[model samples]
Target: MAGHYVIAGKKIPNHILSMGFIGAYAGAYALYALKPKPAQPATPPIQASSSDEEAFIKEFLAKAEAEESK
Candidate 1:
């Protein structure tokens, strides 16, 4: 049924070729299936003090501005 397209003047259907390819690949690996494994977040050794750092930065900026105004 298949001949050189240049000579046979016929184009093969995409679905037919795709199904044949899928069948070939699936038959080659019929017993096994592939699945993506879930990723786990790394555990941190220490927690950050967000509020404390924010307050310290604000207080430091205020002190710096007060000193500059003098």
Candidate 2:
């Protein structure tokens, strides 16, 4: 009664409890290892056109001029 576990007025054997714990541990690891990984989308490398670069440079210069006039 001191070290034994009683469930519903019945005593559970030590071997059964140890097996249940081992089974649960194995099951948890199995699920973790077998879980599906998320698919990552492949991204294309960005190539900036000359027109896009010119537009960006113009915008950046406009912002700098506005900040300087403030």
Candidate 3:
């Protein structure tokens, strides 16, 4: 929805979505060829406490134990 309009102040039809995609791909290609590749910013890794990981393990173990006891 963000880049779905033309700079000429015209509304774009659904069919022109492919054209927008091609233009973006071409721009990216040009950047790749002429510039040093940009480093992606790192996202913070999700940290789970040992207890939280254990809880998930315990849940699966409980299911297995219940099935085994049946």
TM-score of each: 0.31, 0.52, 0.32
Tell me the tens digit of each residue's lDDT in model 2 across 1-70.
3356898999988778888999999999999999999977664434457878868877777799899999
Candidate 1 lDDT over residue span 1-70, tens digit each: 4432232676766667778889999977864555555777764333437978767877777799899999
lDDT of 3: 0.77
Preferred candidate (TM-score higher): 1 or 3: 3
Q: What are the C-alpha RMSDs, in order, of all predicted structures?
A: 13.3, 10.9, 14.7
Against the hidden true structure, what lDDT does model 2 obtain?
0.82
- The TM-score leader among the candidates is 2
lDDT of 3 by residue, 1-64 (tens): 4455565788786558788889999999999899977788664444557888868877777799
Q: Which candidate order results from sorting by lDDT in descending order?
A: 2, 3, 1
Of models 1 and 2, which has the larger lDDT? 2
User: Any runs in candidate 3 off by more than 4 Å, and if so which?
Assistant: 1-12, 36-70
Where does candidate 1 clash, by residue pair? none
Q: Model 1 compared with the native: what TM-score? A: 0.31
